[model samples]
Target: MMTLLSAPTSPYVRKVMVVAHETGQIDRIDPVFALANPTKANEELNNQNPLAKIPALVTEDGAIFDSRVICEYLDATTSTHPLFPRDGKTRWQALTQQALADGLLDAALSARYELLMRPEDKQWSGWRDAQLAKIERALDRMNTDIPDTLTIGAVGYGCALGYLDFRFPEVDWRAARPALADWFATFSERPSMQATLPRD
Candidate 1:
């Protein structure tokens, strides 16, 4: 079985797990809990992934890192439900959607890190506010262009929105984006998403 360095609370790891569940490849992966913090070092994780990131898949070929690459690799393993489109305009659109969701996650993480990781004296409200603003803009874009197909883009959006609910409930993103909220409610019912719900 391939090894998946993971953490229950990591949205990126959750994304990979959701894909594994969706593609009927969950049985093939062995999840190994790994700690990865930006300001700290995790030698075990660093050895496999220079970036010390979670959701790195250790395969016979080598270690595949970061969620996007690993998700694509997993999608290729089975034809059960191809998350990545083969080619053409749909491919680009799906990829763009994934990028948008990932960007939202990046901003959310940045905002959280500023409050949780930075020393109180060093933390900057302005920076955190900027990150939150970015997330708000991304939410508006996602609401405007919800994914109509089940691709990696949909998975990305699901995971990103779930992360917000898990970590930033105070943000109240649903009030302004009812359509996206409704989409997530339905998406969350999928076994893939239900099984990989983010938690601390």
Candidate 2:
């Protein structure tokens, strides 16, 4: 079995978990909660991942960090249902979509950390606002480009939007993007998504 270093509140970790469920590889992963802080001394997580990030995977041979790499590895490992397309333009599209979704998550995470993790005196409103703007722009682009049907990109998008709902409800991302809200309604109903929905 592979050991998955994860934090329950991490959207990136949720992405990996959703992909694992979708690919029927959930049973192979053992979820291990981790707390990694640069200031914290003597943490083994730093050795496994020099960056000390969550969603790190420990396989038999070595460790893999970052949700994208782990999800792709899991998809490739399973022959039954591939979350990422094997070849051609579809693969490119999926990769691009995943990148967009990841970018949204990255911006959102930065905003969140600035508000929640950083000391009040150290918080930078300018940086937070910039990240929020990036997220809004990405959401707008996603609303325009959303596919009529579900695909790898759609799955990633769904997870990214779901994270916003879970962590930043005050932002009201849906009000301005009705189409995306509707699309997310359908996307969120998937069994894989339902199983991985974040909870308290």
Candidate 3:
């Protein structure tokens, strides 16, 4: 079984875990908790992923970094459910939605890092506000284009929304985006989602 370097509260890791469960490939991976901090040194994680990111898959050939690439690798290798749509407009749509959702996650993480990693005196409210604005725009776009298919787009959106609930409870992301919230309400009930909810 391949080893998955992960943390329960990492949204990227949760995305990979959700994909594994959804594709019926969970048994093929061994989830191992990893303590990765950008400010601190993690030799093992650095060796596997130069960026020291989570959800790195230690595969037979080598290690894979980043959630999008890892998720695509899983989608291509797994045949049980096939989370990615085959070539067509649907494929492009799914990939585009995935990119949008991942961008939301990136914006959210950036804002979070500004607050959490930077010193209180050095933290810039302007930077945080800019990132938060990006998140708001992404949420609005997702509300307008909520996907109906079980594709990587759905998985990416689910994980991104889940991370918002986990990290930014004070920010009412659902209030202005009722349609997106309703879709997530239904998506969050899936077994794969239930199994990988981000935790402290």
Q: Give the top-scoring candidate (lDDT).
A: 1
Q: Name the runs in model 2 displaced over 4 angstroms.
A: 148-150
Residues 116-171 of candidate 1 have per-residue lDDT tens digits of 99999999999999999999999999999898989999999999999998999898
Candidate 3 stretches with Cα past 4 Å from truth are none
RMSD, one per candidate, in order? 0.8, 1.6, 1.0
**Residue 167 of model 3, lDDT score:** 95
Show the colliding residue pairs in model 3.
none
In TM-score terms, candidate 2 sits at 0.93
Residue pair clashes in candidate 2: none
Q: For each candidate in the order shown, give its overall lDDT on alpha carbons.
A: 0.93, 0.85, 0.91
Candidate 1: segments with Cα more than 4 A from true spot: none
- Report the C-alpha lDDT of model 2 over 38-115, residue by residue, as the tens digit: 457537788788888888999998999788899889888878756788898878888888899999998998888888
Can you give the lDDT of residue 150 in candidate 3? 92
Q: Residue 6: error of model 3 in Å?
A: 0.9
What's the TM-score of each model vs. the native? 0.98, 0.93, 0.97
